[model samples]
Target: MNKEYTVTDDEVGTRLDVFLSNQPDNPSRSSIQKMITDGAVSVNGQTKRANYKLRLSDNIVMTYQPLQEIEVQPENIPLDILYEDKDIIVINKARGMMVHPATGVYTGTLVNALLYHCHGELSGINGKIRPGIVHRLDKDTSGVMVVAKNDFAHNSLAEQIGSKTAIKEYVALVHGNITEEKGIINANIGRHPVDRKKMAVVTSGGKSATTVFHVLERFKNCTYVKCRLLTGRTHQIRVHMAYIGHPLIGDPKYCNSKNKFNIEGQALHSLNLTLNHPRTNQQMTFTAPIPQDMQNLLNYFRQTI
Candidate 1:
């Protein structure tokens, strides 16, 4: 079944996925991407990228059948909001919280908390079933993330992210003593040839990604590095760091057998995020303190061998 909706002024300047969340049945951003790839979604009769910015009065048409069971329940998960306004909210996502509802992760996700806090304010870019997800960080990576509250804000944020205007920075505890103070890792990142579940640094048949990193401190064996994302690819930082013989500490999937710290997951933290206000045209930056786990890892490296 297909339906058409008129974009109101509020919907203007928001991403299509962000806009869809405000509707009656919210479909998730991932589901919306599939619909877009399958030609089941259109804006003003034109097929556009998932990050397309919607304008006022733009006609949006979507074709999909509602799922028999919708499981996006509101959970009273704790949220650490660093910034919030009418358009968007920047959250300092803690480790152990999934970005959204996914397989094996139906509860205690950021989406659930957003639903609880925002209530009916989230825009439905995918559908009314899922709300307010623009971009995502890994489950184990704690950092700042932005959620769109309305369609206009969602679209505007989408444009900024798509154009690479969104400034994102991460602090990571990586294995190996990096000698360089600053360097850029320009490589092609793609799915691992043998491992479908992991990403790798490939020389061909992949997207070109550039990651600029600065050495913040050097431990006995590990290095504290600040990474600036030039191109946001899946597992870009981890893969690039690993490519240069400095895989993230505690990254079980990619790290070597002999690791100094026995942390739970990869030691990566999103420390900073800067983007333009969807409605205000003002630049905004959100800073997040390093999580306890990461800070402890650094402390361990500092104190012991």
Candidate 2:
């Protein structure tokens, strides 16, 4: 569908991509840039770059072809739902489960399960691929996660995370003993220039990321720590810990060597989540118990350390 807008006085001087992203459609900046590059968007009847500054009363027309809807089939995959209400559902997402389906992955995801559980109530803000997913945990990271049932709840929850009002805490077992009881890592993170599959602490052209950690227990060759995310970036906790010489135990991508522990993936868990209720405005918190694999590893540390 095609949409047109005249830049107003208040919108003058905004980047073209930024201005388009703020529209009601809420297209991603990357998507907007792609549209501009493909000549699907124009300012004053001429194509403009994503960084072009807007001028008041400038006519902007965007021709967006709606994505072909891929049917996200409902799966009866069991979910360990922790909390549920009319607006949202909190689940203790198990390890080894993808949050949503992507290309080449169409089933056995949290979204598929939610489709069955919520029964068509999931919000469509994230498109058909990631319906109701306000945020995500890694595939191997077991944790508490919340899903919105409606667009209103989805918007509110997304705002909370964007504004850093939602609190997310994790517990991780890393490969080295952390000396400090508590500390903060302030660094910029972005995609690795050489390795596109991984994230790294880049010196420039990266987003600012902050992670706070407190040592919970120190083992012979590992540290159990609690991490709070001040800014949510992809692989933020894992990258920050690795930058501090304590890459998470069993982390295949970040850690250089195989872990002594027989765990399949990184020993990281989203232990707690806190946020304000979207509808009621009441503060709420949810917690997930440590999974058995991590728990057994911790017990091993307890007996040996």
Candidate 3:
């Protein structure tokens, strides 16, 4: 049996999942979403996605179900540490290493490595297994990611990122020689109209996304560009790069298959992150070197050009 929650003025306009997270005894937001998916939770007596906005007097009824506990086993994985402290750990995750576990890919992830390295000190965010994850990089996009070690740090880092107080920059090797020294890509990113698996810039009901890019170097058929994300949307950089007619090199999903060079995935790397420490109130900046694969591609380009 689950408890019923009546919405109040303070809870009005709050996302359903967020309201559920405020409850101490209820399962995590993701857990509640699973329950809703399984027809266990009802909003105004009807099922809805976890993101449904609550009104001042809506009825939220939930049937509580025990969630399966996740035992994160530590695997001896090598990590490229850029910086570490009692509150946070920044790592240069190698390409192809998923940030966290998913349906078919459980274990042997960055979370597993962090668990092993940090000795199980991680803060649970929204009740998913990603205890310390503040942001994410693509599976093939290697870069610097900061992981929180405790609740205070987790909350602070997440809030900083959400508020755009944290500065993040990426270096990418995109095809085509962009003549402009700097440019901005502004679009609404949403699920592809026909292909739900991919993202596209559309005029429909989509979130506003912006990316500022600067050309670092020019090649005969490619340009090395640096991107700063003003809004973090799924595949924002890749989608923006493609939308500008200069898809990333070796990007199978967005790039043209008739590419001249041989590479794999987008050559995007999260090179730098800067933010204020949650507990210390001291400004901190971290940088990670470009991964070997991206470096190799750049080296090849410099030689041929």
Candidate 4:
């Protein structure tokens, strides 16, 4: 189906791709750009680049092609469930586990396990692929996460996180010894202009992000620190830590190859999470013990230091 939109006066000067992404249809910018380049999108009856500037009253037409949804199946994967109730379930997500299914990854995700455990009672607000998922932990970052069982609970929990009322804390071992006892990184984050796959501390056209860290222990060349996120931007902690020159140990994406530790992934863990109960409105906190790999690395550091 082809859809048409007239650029409003207020929408003038916006990039063609940006305007399309902000629409209610919510297509990803990459998809929109791809469509534009393929001539699936046209402005003023002519094909335009994704970065073409829009003007008032410009007529834009887009071809709307729905993506084929992949079916997610239930899997009997074991879960370290911390807490469960009528409305929510909290889990200590393991490392190397994805929170939800993506293209080319349909099984062995947290969602697949939730589907089996919840028995189709999980909330569908996030659609089929992310049923009951309220928040996410990166695949390599093991930690605590809460899932909503119903729509009401999902809305409540999402509100708490979006409003910054929910608190999330992490423990990480970084490459360099942090000199400061405690510090805050207040920077704007955006997709890296050169490497679109990575996030960076951007100076312009970025969203505000803040992370506070306190040094827990310092080794000869590494520091164990606790970090609290004030904003939930993608890779916020990793980007902020790397920006400050103390990338997390074993962080393959952000850190250089100078890491001496033979670890599979970043030495970061979601140590604690605090939020209000959706049903009772009572404050609740959950903590997950550090994974064995991180602990072993820490022990090695201790012996060496």
The C-alpha lDDT values of all candidates are 0.84, 0.90, 0.84, 0.89
Tell me the tens digit of each residue's lDDT in model 4 across 13-123: 999998886665445577688788889999999999999999999999998644245778999999999999999999999999989875335689999999999997999
Off by over 4 Å in 4: 1-68
RMSD of 1: 13.5
* TM, every model: 0.75, 0.78, 0.76, 0.79
- 1 versus 3: better TM-score goes to: 3
Model 3 agreement with the true structure over 142-238: per-residue lDDT tens digits: 9899999989999999999999999999999987889999999999998776444578899988899999999999988889999999999999999
lDDT of 1 by residue, 24-58 (tens): 44455676677787888898899888788988888
How far off is residue 35 in model 1, in Å? 26
- After superposition, the stretches of candidate 1 with alpha carbons farther than 4 Å from their true spots are 1-69, 128-130, 258-262
Q: Output the lDDT of residue 47, model 4.
A: 97
TM-score of 3: 0.76
Judging by lDDT against the true structure, name the best candidate.
Answer: 2
Error of 2 at 245 (Å): 0.6
For TM-score, the strongest prediction is 4
